[model samples]
Target chain A: MALKRYRHDWLYSFCSVFSMIAFMVPMLTVLGIKDGIVGTLTRRLLENPRNREISPIGTRAFRPEFFEALITHPDAEFLVPETREISATMNLIAEGYPSFDGDLYSSAPGDPLLSETLDPQALSHQLALGEIYVSQGVAEKLGLSEGSELTGRVGRRQGARNEYGRLPLKVMGVIPRHITPKYNVFCSLDLARMTEDFRSGYAVPELGWKGKEKGSEIPVYSRFRLYSRDLDGVERLRLHLLGLGVDTLTQAAQIKLVKDLDHSFTVVFLALFVVVGGGAFASAASGSIDQVVKMRRSLAVLALLGISKLRLLVFTMSQAALTGFLAALGAEALFLALAKTLNSYFGGSMGAVEEVCSLSAFKLVAAAAIIVVFMTAASGCAYTSLADIEPSEGMRDV
Target chain B: MDPSPQKTKNGAKEASPPDPDVSDDVILNCADLVKTRKGGVGYRLLVESMTIGRGEHLALIGDSGSGKSTLLDMIAMVLKPDSAGDFSFRPIGHAKWHDLWKIWRKGAYGIFEALRRSELGYIMQTGGLLPFLNVADNITLPADLKPGFPKAEKRERFKALTATLGISHLLGKLPSAISVGERQRCAIARALIHAPSLVLADEPTASLDPPTADRVFELLLDLCRDSALVVSTHEQNRVLTGRFKVWRIDCRPGGEGQPIEARVAPLKDRAPAAALPAGRVSLAKSLSDSVH
Candidate 1:
């Protein structure tokens, strides 16, 4: 009993140990890689214009309460993409900030800021009514700091500066100086609504175009970019807004391709687990059977020496558990080291996206659980061998 | 009321106390102990009555088809009897005859294994030593397997076994590396190292050459001088001496509507007035009638 559990034929030993580690390490590695990819794909999928667009389906215009209803959805974030020409100076009263030709942007803060933007968080704060965040170019030209105010004139695109009304806005913050085309201003919807030009509602937008009939008389949005908190529900929200006779700008093929990629990764992970898990289990079971067949005489000898069937069974189970434990240790060591190396590799490539090539607590737990299941099947073989063994050779089955 | 009871002499009429490991006078008593099996062919083994005392050696002999091994296994409680009657061994509470050992009748195999490990030792034809273990480990195996069997005295007893068997220098070698005689000597050591009262050796010397077999048998008989040794073998010439009694076990195939028949009897030598039992006389005649 002492040597039996630890001792194995070279072939059996190599096969069992190799298969165990093979099952654990590669499965975990694939899962980590899948998670890294899924994280990126999910983010990109949600950030895609196809998933975030909203517009009137055809000739129909939005109802008076359509905007309010869409905004009330838990996942929905309403945005007005219309830009109006404005001329402004600093706060209500002061020596005044340097005024410049600045284009104003009005939208919710959670919008997917362009990847080309060097400092994404520079405009991370939400814009309140009567407040604004200026890009670095605008900030430098106006010489505005935090708590400074800018007086802007909002009117027709060709309206004269003195012809427009004065719109006083506070400069709450400044965008960092990195991204190009930095003369942009960010403000809330309420601030945009205060402008007389925007107050004159425009034509309702279609799926991809903001236009009105040659002769029509109804309030319409030039364009609106819609967003959902979770991409899983984004399609449903899109359908809801589309049901309201709105056509959203969506590349269904691109979104489906990303979603299909996500599903493929899931299938790969599961298939990898089954293939590896099945191989490990088969190796364990065969190893157990081989040991029993080759060591029958020895087992009978032990039985003759008075080791009970139960102890013999436990002895066999210990071998499997020990094998699994040793394999897990080796696999984990290899897994963690590999994850670290690949983490840096992925980090170097995907900038600012979290969770690149990292393992989860659940994977370790799953590996342990799989090892236990393997041991259980292996020990079952041993138990059967014990049950079949007779105390002595040439003895009749009784 | 005396706590310690009196021990009878060898082959005594009465059994000794429960603790027989230290006692010299001990007896194993049985009446009508029987064992049987049936299949395409049938087997019925029986021992009408018998007693084995400490320092007594019995050589069980028979023809090629005789049930010598079966008889030895039955005596050691390795095989459950077809039907057993009025049997016990001493000392009274020795594990071999304890309440647990009674499970042999109920087919409680674990109890029989425990009895074998702690109370009796078995030596099979092939040495029955585990291949992976070295000579020393095989010798001490029964001791370790026997729970609560004086674990501290193992080293001392092992040293004694090595010295007695003259295999001390070969302790570290695997069974594959050893000579046949050396292997058999190791088997004998393994049997006696645990201090079992009864040592059942089936063909202990059957596999050795004549010269090596002689030496191995002498060593076994010598070491078992203080214990109850029952050896089953075909080496009748070597065991014909007065120091050892011969027990021949024979099985006669039964006819239709009748049970398989078997018999056990003492094979005595050179007694003109002694007539063998009628059923056994003819088989005995061919042996005794021949000149030695």
Candidate 2:
């Protein structure tokens, strides 16, 4: 019966349904654009793997226990110990290229920079006792490639005398320029420790270089470079390192910008929803009131026919519910079309993984539910007129 | 009008009180029912005594503003009387009589609504068919409101009634699409479709032409053979020629500031007695079954 009434007054019903669609589609579109834009920006920030790296600004002796505890930290993805800046440099000479100095750093398993270019297990295997990995900058400067033989010479000032140690090295791999943009050389922890010891005027029996005999000393690292498990973990790891009096540098500001962008979009969307949604609600409610007033004769006839007042109320509300549900469906279809158009228009510039407008399936369902509920409430606001229709009014000549 | 009129303190004539020994054949009995319309030129309608017998045909005739519609509304229980000395109704085949005024005072509107659904039917002057529905749906609405009305029986009656009313062709059309005469016939069909024990038609043909009004009025009277009927109409000649028991409202004009007073009184001839059809079902039993 309610459906019959709705169908009988299709023009009025159409207007009400369209009003609801007008309210809902804008809200859904704004939300989708917000999610898409913010998601794309955040994804762009995460594209550079180095953005997840946290390195201390200056040097300090960090104990073995500190390294062990830091590795157990929840956000720590990868960590490697480094020697002092003075001993970390070496003069490299390749057969076909001019000699140049390369900054040395320790390399170990799960080194994200090397793992980005080569498999982690393979990279670990290649970091043997006399092997080294060179950055693309170093490779370009010294004319180095994998399997190329090179000589790394370290010179030390020994009380007005210049002492030099030479080590035979093979270029095991070259890290990508994007991963390590500076001219640097990477070697195993044992090799880096030996270099630091030789620079401190100690003997390195492995290279048969002469100096003071080695003594028992607990090894301490002057610096460490760590990568987080993900982009979001960078700030957490940086803060954790800061708690230990070490100020670390990472791309936390870029991540904050994305968060702020999300917040701003939400506020703007809410304001739009309040204004447009209020108007739509008023339109739908007043339209329902007008329809009920026009149909009071028919409603009174039903009452005169002995249909309960409660049933009459249900009849009126059922029509509103139908209108709301239909509007939600219309809004969903419109939103999908708009989202597709926007995504297509912007998809060329952004990568395939990023969309300019997007909404999750869960959000779509939730929006539909909310629209239906809202429309029903709007109808409820007009129930007084329906209830006031008297059955005796059906007796009048009018 | 053989009964003597007694004068009230306000100088209005009051008809005799209702008969205390109501027989089993009587359907409704009322006495001393009063309703006051409070407004400029206040009006009051008084029904001193009245009775509608089972299978009886009664016509209410009066001038305009004489409270014919008000009296009919009160009898139909749609309008509550301000006070009642006695108002009782016995549904056909029911052993017990229901106190109509007591039910009203209790605010038991559902009972009144259910009675209207299962036992009484009303027809308005303008053919009060729902505009959204087709003629067929409008006619079947009363039966549809009944919870367990037999669909096969309803269909059979619908065909017979529409055929009888000459409205079989207009069943698929909406009320707005039909003529006034056709709509009136449709209203008659709706009022009789449920087989109610009482049918009230208030100027059912007042909007139709002479021939159509005659035809519709005759059809309404003919189809109500097995039920009681109270019809209010201006077609006095036809009603009198049909030999229906006539009730007229007599109003006394008010003075400059006083309210007008009116009372219902029986006219000369009672309707000719007719035999009841066999196997008439009790409206109470039907109502009870349909509701519960």
C-alpha lDDT of residue B8 in model 1: 16
Cα lDDT tens digits, model 1, B163-188, are 98899999988888998789889988
Candidate 2, B1-292: lDDT as tens digits: 1122321221221123335587777888887888899897789888999989888999997666678889898888788887776777777888767777767767898988888888788888999888888999889989888768799989998999999999999989999998999998999899989888789999887788889988887887788887899999755665765557889776765557877778789876543323211222343342233235
Separately for all candidates shown, the number of backbone clashes (residues 3 or more apart, or on different chains) is 6, 0
Q: After superposition, how far is residue A303 of candidate 2 from its true place, in Å?
A: 2.4
Candidate DockQ values, in order, are: 0.26, 0.55
- All candidates: interface RMSD: 3.7, 1.1
- Over 4 Å off in model 2, which ranges? A44-55, A64-219, A222-246, A350-353, B1-29, B88-103, B106-108, B253-258, B269-292
TM-score of chain B of each: 0.78, 0.82
Cα lDDT computed for each candidate against the true fold = 0.65, 0.82
TM-score: model 2 vs. ground truth? 0.78
lDDT of 2 at B141: 88
